[model samples]
Target: MIKGFILIFLLGASATYCIAQHNKAKSAAIIVTGKVLSQADSNLVKELFFDGLHEKIVNNFQRASTNFNKVLEIDPANDAAMYELANIYHTQNQEADAERLIRMAVTVQPENNWYWLLLADIYKQTQNMAQLVPVFDELIRLSPANEDNYFDKANALLMQNKVNEATAVYNSIEKLYGSSEDLSNARQRILIQQGKPGKAAAELEKLVISNPSDLGNYLSLSEIYAKSGKRDQAIAVLQKAALADPANALVRLSLADHYRALNKPDDAFIELKVAFADPNLNIDDKVRIILSFFPQFADYKARAYADELASITAKTHPDDPKAFSVYGDVLYQEQKYSEAKEEYKKALVLNDQVYQIWEQVLRIDITESKFKDAITDGEAALAIFPNQAPLYLFSSIAYAQSGNHEKAIAYLKNAADLETENKDVISQIFSGMGDSYNALKRYSESDQAYEKALAADPDNSYTLNNYAYYLSLRGENLEKAAKMSKRSIELDPGNSSSEDTYAWILFRLKKYADALIWIEKAMISGKVVNAVQLEHYGDILFFLGNKEQALLQWTKARQAGSASEKLNQKINEKKYIE
Candidate 1:
């Protein structure tokens, strides 16, 4: 409410405002060492005072203080000098000196609101609410039309925990100038802060009754009633608000909350659906309500209700990207991948600025094995967010699957650098890099990448299985591969891929009997048999001296759709190759 002085000119302005533009202080040289200069004797008082004004205007407070002090010594009852010196002292944090000087200024010029206002500030600094009341009272008497005086007085009263006095001040505002939001809100807040909810409720109720068109007053009143356990009264207030504003989204939202509190889901959902469908409700607010109030998608009934609301939100706000984004989230949670992608794409069309939405689109593309779509979306995302690690990782996966192993390795390397701290995530990136190198037939680079992956996260089951399998395929480091493969199986128990890698490593190690046990476990434990697992089983069988069974297994491998290059020759020769 007060503009604390900063510049030299503003201090002059304050002096000008207080004195109603008194004549500029003239400069004069006066030596006071000989005797104390009385007010009448020091005919150069105005000149010395103006010199002080000039010094203060230049922001030289020390010089200004000296000039004003001399003026007071000469003119003992100079109110203007007292006010100026008090302001300087207050700015220097000399509150006691400032208080005394300002108090004397107010006593000399009791009709000046500016002096009283400064006095009030000094009282505020000293935390003397008792003196502040009389100061503001005098300010109000001096300028009765200044509403700020009333607010200042009320706030000071509230600081003293004199809530009733504060309420009276607000009431006085209503009497002087009809009931207003500023007055009602201030009074109601103080009453509520004082633990007088009943008084707060009554004050709001009066506003609601006096101005039925003000939906905010009704909502505030309803909240108070609801918090006080007057559920029926709360609902009644919202119901009346609904009557006034039939299509009001906030009213519907309030009604929905009240119905939910009463355990009426059917009624609550009806109100919520209308509220969500209302375009007047800001899209962000709708998203906030759905996220904060609605149950997560894990709850079946709640998911259904939330899905319906999300659909309504999208329909009402077709152009708003957030509405479609949230609806896409609901679909994504329900595992409707294709539909979710379409909704997310719609959001991207409306606005491509949000990285999360683009990430969601790529995530769905990856999940559905849409490598082409994933590549395109990942490229687009990277164009906008070039440093996003997840985008790099996803793009690498898409490129890898599309047989662009060199590009995949590049993206993986960059992603590894970008995502450094999270060991699990970095391990995934390094493991991907290893796979890409292996695909490019750069086995040494592949092995180094795998080692880096393991260094980051020792328990990375995917890395363990893949690295061990790659080593087993090359017939090098079979002993270490066997250990890693076995640990991979232990870390992620019942995963057929890990089990198959372990069994194949055992076969390479010439532990054919142990290999036979694990191959059969992979076959029986898994829902579907892949060609590698079947071919590995054949190799183990032939090595264990079961040539006939090996041929039969090799034929099964050919039909299983991922048979190795040597599988056909092994079946034709009725012997395991490699």
Candidate 2:
């Protein structure tokens, strides 16, 4: 046996990242071979090899490499030791060394299944696909019954786009072990990629005969027929699947897909209803199928179908909270807030631990101006999830809306430390604190909180608009407020709230003509122009010496639910009032 130190350099390129702003390329290396020498003792070589394996298992790759090299020194033709060291080299990303050693090991131990497999793996990892097929072929010759070897060889060939060779490998698999779904599907894929859909259909047809009991095989065959524009043939094959098992729900789903492709949406809906009603199909699979088609359900008609399908899913799986939650999601998206709330309530009754479902219910309550209900529900949810920062933030908003700023402030402070790394959530909590402080007439605290919120997320348009508007209301920092409100409008282009805020800031700065332009833009935005916007428009007009129109707008503001104390005064006195 040869006993000389083999200098195994770990051949990985390392480049220093620039602190000096220049590329400094250098190759970093480590010596992997060992110094320990021994006579050709077979027993000692075996012990050292096992010791090397144990070291590798413990993640001590350097020591493992040392032991393996020592074993190889004791027995120069130790293919097992050579393979282990090659694996270490591969792990270290020393690809050249790994490939060389693995190749040598395979040559030394041609009959060893593992040596050939390692060589195959090395070839694959190096992207040297041209050499991989022969190694897998040798593995097959060595262990002909190993089915994985056949698949690996086919996959390797497919990687090279060797369509003929890959199909041949699949054919060989079928000839040796009979036609199977895996082999036939693999071959059909190659045929399809080769743009021979006709030949792909032939392959699946053969697989359908061999695997006659697998409904999946018939489905695949039907799809291939459809892909090849043989719609009639596809329907006939799906009919066979139905006759094969009259209760198979998947066949109904397949027919629905075919009918949709044929533009017979009504027929598709009928088949979809049949499929959704079948208990044989797993509900989880049904959920996945429906979600996959969500993009197609963007139109009102298809969305209604989606709602119907979601309803069927819920009734089919009445015990599953997820089913009701999905149904609520559909209704919520359609703006059927009341129906969505009922479905969400049903879901909570079944399982109230789901935070997102509670969040959805709370959002609807807030949207519908049910602040007391929102506050109550939020408190119950907080008792269950005490550490959730978003719940506290949302609950504080409800409290603030209910004119309970002290409760809102307490909740917002409690939320400050529970936040995760999401800066938007953190920013929103601070912004909520700002609003609560402003509502309580604590201007200094409100300013500090708004500053902190901007620090967390400088681009938050809500914080910009609110802080600017509050500063304008206090009649302080009019210049700063003008800048911030303008920025808010730039951030959310065409937003009525931001535009109204900008107009109000301009009015506070005594720029009446500029304020009038922005106020008119906000009024015509096609969105709901809230009472505050109308009141601001009246103030802007009054400042611009249009008292008649200004008083008219103030009345409109009061009529539109302005709850502002100065609004009635402005209309009755026929002048602008803050």
**Off by more than 4 A, model 1:** 1-139, 178-210, 293-295, 545-548, 562-565
Clashes of each: 1, 0
For residues 1-578, could you state the per-residue lDDT of candidate 2 as single tens digits? Answer: 54445432222211111212343323333333434444447678878899999999999999999999997776665678889999899888898998777765654556677777777777888898777776776778788999889999889889999878887888788888985677778877888888988988887777778777888888888888888889979989998988888767889889988998899988888888888898667888777766755686677777878889889999998888888898898888889998999999999999999999988989998899899989999998999989888888888889999999999989988889888588998899889989989988999999999999999999899999999999999999989988888888888988888888888888888888999999999888737767888888888888888888888888888889977677888887888655
RMSD of 1: 8.6
Instruction: Please identify model 2 stretches exceeding 4 Å from their true place.
Output: 1-46, 57-60, 87-98, 127-129, 144-196, 199-212, 246-249, 278-285, 292-298, 318-321, 341-358, 376-388, 414-427, 451-578
The candidate maximizing TM-score is 1
RMSD of each: 8.6, 9.5
Query: What TM-score, over all chains together, does every model reach?
Result: 0.76, 0.71
